[model samples]
Target: MTVENTAEATEVGETTEVTDTTEVPAPVEDAQIERALEAILMVADEPMSVVTLATAVGAPVKRVRAALAAIVADFDGEGGGVRRGFELREVGGGWRIYVREEFDHVVADYVLQQNPTKLSQAALETLAVIAYKQPISRGAIASIRAVNVDSVVRTLLGRGLITELFTDSETGAINYGTTDLLLSQLGINSIDELPKISPLLADGADGFEGDVR
Candidate 1:
């Protein structure tokens, strides 16, 4: 009977140990949460919703919101710190990090200093196609170039040289076109002023015979 009592006590102690281990969770650190938010916001192209950020960091929405407020305060020099050149802003029902409006020209000048030359070869070719046959689809440009133009198109769009004019009704393909920025760069008032393609492509390959205009 003493042996039986000892065995039961041991079992109860083991169960208690297991219960103690299972009841505790690893502590969530504030610095860890802040770092996670920084990493995610750095690469996010669009504004992130609080719920999305909470889901990403495995924290509750309220906690994530509080963290965001804390981060903004930290960046804004509210706690007797240096004011950051960038700021966290809430727009379109979401949150994103943006350069402060006062520093717009500073950033733009730095970017221009980094690349002060003409457009890249791929960008030039893509711009040429858009300048001539614009309101054209990516697939059409790819067919003409005999290579994929997705990245090139994106570059042109980013540079403000091209824009999405419209989407096809049946195929739903986005049609791209040259922007006024391109016209200004080309020193032409309108796309109609572009040089004739046939003369320029007299010695070109098989797929280069069409008039882009």
Candidate 2:
């Protein structure tokens, strides 16, 4: 006689795993997000997207967008606050900090009257990027440098090292190039006279023809 298998029959040593996969959102603080955004924007060279800011600060996009709005309002002197010289502005499909229109001359004067001291290491690095990649936008230079190059670029321009080559009609961004003054100082006739990049570093690339001992 064989035992009949029924619906209640269970196999020995068989087990079932029931997992709770419900995703719980992390805690969000609007004020904290605003502060984080401020810090990031301070160093950012280009306008930042809400999604990008959200990912950087590990917050929701909705919260980041709201935080950006609040920042704009705060800088605009809304809710009985003092107006700021710099404002958070939306442009070129992203958000960035910009000086108020009325404060433009003040910033310009400050940049022009800066002491003629030696270029800072930051300026040197930014200049190198511009040299290697001529006709590059300020945003691109900043992207390569991984920091805001606004002040440095202005300094370079003031020092006659770099000049605005052209403006993008679509984005309105000014692309920069090393000027004749830069070439004169470097003793190079043309930008192509700059040394090839692969020769400078040591034993990094197999294709590099440098004599690396």
Task: Give the candidate number with the greatest lDDT.
Answer: 2
Write down the worst ten-residue block by lDDT for model 1: 1-10
Give the poorly placed runs of model 1, Cα more than 4 Å off: 1-28, 120-213
**How much is the lDDT of residue 110 in candidate 2?**
69
TM-score list, all predictions: 0.50, 0.49
| lDDT on C-alpha atoms for all candidate structures | 0.73, 0.76
lDDT of 1 by residue, 40-76 (tens): 8877755688988988887888988988988899889
lDDT of 2 by residue, 34-88 (tens): 8889999987766777888888888888888889989999999999999999999
CA RMSD, predictions in order = 9.0, 12.5
lDDT of 1: 0.73
Q: Please list all clashing residue pairs in model 1, or write none if there are none.
A: none
